[model samples]
Target: MVTIHELFQNDGQKSRIGTTYNKILYVPESVLQTIREYLDAQSESEYQGEDNTIIYTAKFPDGREMDIKCCGCQEESSWTEAVLFDEKGYQLTYTDVGEKFEGLWELEYDGIHYCVDVKPERNNSKMED
Candidate 1:
């Protein structure tokens, strides 16, 4: 099992998909509190949360950069994540899909509240009902 510690590692490793979650889930309570505190400190940071979806620039201590875009946040149901890019925003996609899109993505899934300034898993983008 992938622990919260593993999911939120800040060491610049790209996260891998271990399983598909059936429903929306929050980061473990212990981790949630930590994330909340971290996010609170970055309150001045700006992102797309106001308009439902999220589009923000993320920088890591390891000198990596990427723009994250999360969709379907304003709706009560249905969340769609996008394929994103590295460095400055551009375009990318899973070669298997052949559905090319601009941008590199992050996260085990879409829209995890309190992950405002925290970098998400650089792999595993998806849309779940």
Candidate 2:
């Protein structure tokens, strides 16, 4: 029952706001651990140089299942884009990780903007908005 909020910031005022999409997901802790392990493994490997897609399964509390997909480059670059798709194959979220701002990243999902220090791990951490 973990909740994730999309955060936005005002550059001029340096203020932040959180917007909850009222999205809820019912995912097992084991699944989260698996996702973390997969990402950690990918981070340690050379697969990033090639086009890679990591797929995993998630189930909702009401018994709906989804296939989560993450696509990105594994190269050491100043900037990279990772796109996540929903179970219906719709583009669920877009993330830009670049050196233009060190240790910062931007995310757009469901037509909303979010400023995050770290990329949301998998399929918005298996969230449903």
Candidate 3:
């Protein structure tokens, strides 16, 4: 172990940390593809979300599964998150492609490809006059 003085004086950012996954999020195939092509063409999607369903795996190409969150958004902006996990259930990486996700985009992590695709449903109610 390095001392506190050595940490500040010398290189202190040389340590590696490990993490664990407590939950898994999944997304639909069509939804994910749309998100992947967002940069190429700006578009909109209408998702259906009346029931609270906890997704376990995503319907992806090559039959590989991943976790993506699908929440309803009836506002100006929404939040989307996609977490990639290995077969052993260890989280490899994640992506936040909603809200202010712009500029140079890195769609791959640990040799795997992924992007942001949050399916937020819109359920409106009319008031009687």
Q: How many clashes in each candidate?
A: 6, 1, 3
Cα lDDT of candidate 3 equals 0.38
Candidate 2 per-residue lDDT, tens place, 47-126, comes to 33335544443333322233334333455322334344455656566554322211233444554443323223454463
Model 3 alpha-carbon miss at residue 33, Å: 18
Residues 70-122, candidate 3: write the lDDT tens digits: 33343222344555665666776766654322222224554344433333322
lDDT of 1 at 98: 15
lDDT of 1 at 77: 28
Off by over 4 Å in 1: 1-51, 60-64, 73-82, 94-129
Sorted on lDDT, best first, the list reads 2, 3, 1
Residue runs of model 2 more than 4 Å from their true location after superposition: 1-20, 42-93, 97-129
Q: Model 2, 95: alpha-carbon shift in Å?
A: 1.4
Model 2, global lDDT: 0.39
- TM-score, per-candidate, Cα-based: 0.24, 0.30, 0.31
lDDT of 1 by residue, 20-109 (tens): 212222223343333333333323342213355433443433223333343322222212333434344444331222111122233332
